[model samples]
Target: MAAPYRSREGLSTRPGAYGGSSDEIQLRIDPMHGDFDEEVSGLRKQVRKLRDVAQEIETEAKFQNDFLNQLMEKVLMPTALRNELPD
Candidate 1:
C-alpha cells in the first residue's frame, strides 16, 4: 500500500538537470500569432532567476545551521559540561 507519487525513487516533480529544450523551443499557441519564441525566452529567464534565488536561500540556511552547531559545541556545550564535572 504505497502512495502513487512515492516509490522511493525520488519525487516526480523534480525537473532533471537535462530535461531538454522544450521550454526553450516554442509552440504557436494562437493561429493569429503571438511571439511564442519571445514568450518562452522570457519564461526561461524567469526560471533561471528563481533558481538562483532558491540556491541563495539554501546556502544561507546551511550557513546558519553550521554556525549554530559550532557555537553550541564551542561555547554552550563546553560550559554545560564543565559545570557538570565533579571537582
Candidate 2:
C-alpha cells in the first residue's frame, strides 16, 4: 500500500501545487461568486419591472381621479346655481 498522505503546514504534497488550502478555497468560492452575481442581476431586473408597474398604476389612478372630479363639477354646478335662485 502507498504511504498515507500527510499535509505539512496545510501544503499539498504534489509537486508544482501552489498555496494548498487557500487555493482550494478560492477554487470553491469562484463559481459561487459568479452565481451570486447572476442572482443579483435577476433581482434587479425584477425590481425594475415592479417599479414600472407601480408607476403605470399611479398614473392611471391620477387620471381616474381627475375624470371623476370633472364629472362631479359638471353635474353639481347647475343644481347648486338653481338652488340659489328664487322661485
Q: Candidate 1 at 71: error in angstroms?
A: 1.3
- Top lDDT hit: 1
lDDT of each prediction vs. the true structure?
Answer: 0.62, 0.61
Off by over 4 Å in 2: 1-34
The segments of candidate 1 whose C-alpha lies over 4 angstroms from its true place after superposition are 1-33
The root-mean-square deviation over C-alpha atoms between each candidate and the true structure, in angstroms, is 9.5, 19.8
Q: What does candidate 1 score on TM?
A: 0.56
Cα lDDT tens digits for candidate 2, 1-87: 122233222222333356444222111224533576664575577669979999999999999999999999999999999999999
**Winning model by TM-score:** 2
> For model 1, what is the error of residue 38's alpha carbon versus the real structure, in angstroms, after optimal superposition?
0.4
